[model samples]
Target: MAKEKIVLAYSGGLDTSIILKWLKETYDAEIIAFTADIGQKDELDGLEAKALATGASKVYIDDLRDEFAKDFIYPMFQAGAQYEGQYLLGTSIARPLIAKRMVEIARAEGATAIAHGATGKGNDQVRFELAAAALAPEIAVIAPWRLPEFREEFPGRAEMIAFAEKHGIPVTASAAKPYSTDRNLLHISYESGVLEDPWFDASDAESKGMYLLSVDPEDAPDQAEMIELEFAQGDVVAINGKELSPLEVMEQLNELGGKHGIGRVDMVENRFVGMKSRGVYETPGGAILFAAHRKMESLTLDREVMNLRDSLITRYSTLVYNGFWFAPERLALQALVTESQRNVSGTVRLKLYKGNVIAAGVKSPVSLYNPEIATMEADPTQAYDQGDATGFIRLNALRLKVNSGVEQNQK
Candidate 1:
């Protein structure tokens, strides 16, 4: 009989590296290591050779930067999904796409089981398993972190290092950096380690090095930089008069935003698993995009429509943060979000200065803003009649007046 096959979400990191070897030894299965190339610059270097040397029977490295931006990142940005009012849902958004691809690879490779290196206690485990269960319910999920035998074998990073050395598995992880990080096209996040302490200041020397996507705000250039973003139905289509692909747009914005230190956030967020976790994130491009997108919508979207959509942002954000990317309610809400962006086509000029994305100007062809009626210069030809306000205010204040009369009578 053929050996059972397992598709492992391989990152060439310490945890996944050890999991790859451990899976091979424990299950005695054919391991196909899969790495999703979601724009983690040098992290993908030599991944194939490393996976092969670490005992993977086959290795698959996929370039998913464009798909990640267009399919996952852009839609979430369009919805203005910001978890806990700060997190751009960077790491949270990437997991579903990665898990979906993992399931696809498993089906294509005829693998009976899929594996991930997400810790048992973290959100990634929930995200990965929930996505897998939604996408491919028949496939078994092999979570090494949840396995007792695996935990016993490698209790800590030191033991994992020793095991890798004994098995000739080359790894680049070290005990020096106490935090764990996840990076993608959208953003870079730093968590765990010293970050577990909610009061730990991230500005200290030890934590400063963890930032890869943006510079320190204090260290940024003295001058502010102005840029224009063009949007088509809510998604950013161009930057500074240049039409670029989704990936290129993200890369360019990230470069510009990073130089100005425009997007750095540290907050203690309520996790989906019912715990409070502190995380530091650098989402330079996403921050720029969100600010620009909102500015454009302000010019084009109607007042009541924008208000209704804004009301749903928190719920939509919660759904995404909770790993409901494939859930029906999320899909339904996304439909409404997509409808809300129908006329959100415009250009927004912004000034980036020392961690602030300031909107300078915004305009749209289908804008509902009327300069004539809005002007305080008192135009005679303006259609908005000053006489209308007397009746409007009296009608609106009738209930208030009636309530006051009732209270006065009682007194």
Candidate 2:
């Protein structure tokens, strides 16, 4: 009889390596290791060999960079979904895409179950399982971290490391550096280990040369760099007059923003599992794009439309942060956000210097900012009649006068 097959999201890391070997032994099933490349860069090196050597019947490494940027990142950015008014949802935004790909691989391979390396304490576990449940309900999820038996055998990193050593599974984790990180096209996040302490100085991380995507802001070039971004319906279409695809745009901006030392954030955020966690993130490109996009919107979006969309930013950001990417409510919110961007087309000039994305100027053919109507020195156009202020002020003050009169009578 053919053995049941299980699809595992393998990252060639310590936890995943141990999980891969344990799954093969415990389930006695054919393990199909799958790795999704969503702009992890050199982290994909020798991943297939590592997975195969760790006892996998088959290995699939799929590149999902383009789809990740276009379908996932673009839509979220359109809604301006920044968690806690600071986090750009970089790590949060990438989870659903990764899980979606895992489900597809599981379906194509006819695997009855899917597994992930996300810990029970983190948000990724929720994201992976929820996405699987939404996409393919029949497929079973094997989360070793949540299982009592699995936790008993491996209580900490040392246990997992010893298991990997005994099982001939190569791992890079050791006692020296114990922090954890998650990376993608958008950004890289560092947490746990020494970073677990809320008082740890994130600025010191720069001196220690811990950042990967960017240099220290103090080390940035003395002269500011100037660039222009062209947008069409809230999506960046061109950078400095050159049209590029979404993936290319990300790559280019990452390079530029990195050189300028932009987009480093350190904060203590509330986790979905009802705990506070300290995380330090480097999201160079995403910062630049977000600032430019908001500047572009200022020139084109109607005041009311912009305000209505801004009011939902918190809700939209929370949905993504809590791993509800595939939820119906998020989709409905996306539809509304998309409609709000119908005329958000413009070019924004920016100055990049010392970790700052300074908006230099903005212009759009469909701009609502009418200079003729707003000018104080001109009367020839008569676009806005100065005489109208008398009636307008009186009408607006009527409610205030009525309220004051009532209060006075009561007194």
Candidate 3:
């Protein structure tokens, strides 16, 4: 009989690395390590060799940066999705893509079950399982952190560190660096460690180790930098009049915005697990992109359509944050958000400086902002009707008038 094979979403981190070896020794099953490349530059270097040495039979490295930014990030940006008005869903947005690929590899490798290192308390376990359920329902999921024996074997990071040290697993976790971090092209998230205390203000918040994707606002260039961004059907297609692919556009914006210190957010937000957690995020490119995208909508999108999207942003953000990215409801909302951006073809000039993305100017071919007709300083009778205001105002005020009359009669 063929040896049972299990594929794991391997980050080559301390937890996953230990799990890889544990899976091989305990079950005597073949272990395949799969790493999704969503722009963790230095993190992926030497990962394959490390995984193989640590007990993985086969290793798969996928460069998902372009797909991540374009397919997942861009569409979420189209919806202006922000969980609790602070989190850009950086980690939330990347989870589904990684989970989907893991499922595919499981089928290709003929694996009996898939595994992840997500802790029992986190949202990632829910995300990985939900995406797997949506994409490949047949594959069994083996979450070691959720397993009784696994939890007993390694109760905390200290035991896991001892396991790695005893086995020579080339572990990276240390007592000094106790924080858990997750990184992608979109952002880097740091949790636990010194951050467990809600009031611990990150030291040197500007040039500090906290923000990787942004420069210090104090260190930002003295002069504001301007760049023109082009969009079509809600996807950014160019920067500074140079046409480029969606991926290239983000790459450029990331560099540009980072240099100017454009995006950095620190907030205490309500997590889906019914707890308030403090987090800091650096989304330099996303911040600039959202600023430009909303400016474009002001020009091209219809009032009702924009209002509908505005009302639904919270729901969309919740879906992403709660790990329901692959749900039909999310897809349905994306369809409507994309439909609303059909006429959102335009260019916006933005000046970035001191953590600010200022809309210097904007223009769209389908712009509803007609300066000639909207001018209050001058007269344009073709579109403006002075005579229509009498009934319009009276009809709108009727409810207020009736309420006042009723109150007077009671008095």
Candidate 2 lDDT: 0.91
- Model 3: CA > 4 A from native: 175-178, 203-207, 407-411
- My TM-score estimates for the predictions, one after another, are 0.96, 0.96, 0.96
Which regions of candidate 2 are displaced past 4 Å? 205-207, 402-411
- Which ranges of candidate 1 are over 4 A from the true structure? 380-382, 404-411
lDDT, residue 373, model 1:
71
lDDT digits (tens) for residues 335-394 of candidate 3: 999899899998999889888998899998888998877887665656877678999999
lDDT tens digits, residues 103-198, model 1? 999999999999999887788899999899999999999999999988988888899999989999887776688888898998989888888888
lDDT (C-alpha, whole model) for all candidates: 0.91, 0.91, 0.88
Per-residue CA lDDT of model 2 for 1-411, tens digit only, reads 889999999989988889989999999999999998998989999999999999999999999999999999999999998998789988899889888988898889989999998999998899888888888999999999999999999998888888987888888976465578889999989889888888878787433566889989988999999999999998998999999898988989999999999999999999999999998999999999999999999889999999999999999999999989999999999999999999999899999999999999999999999887777787677878889999999999999999999999998
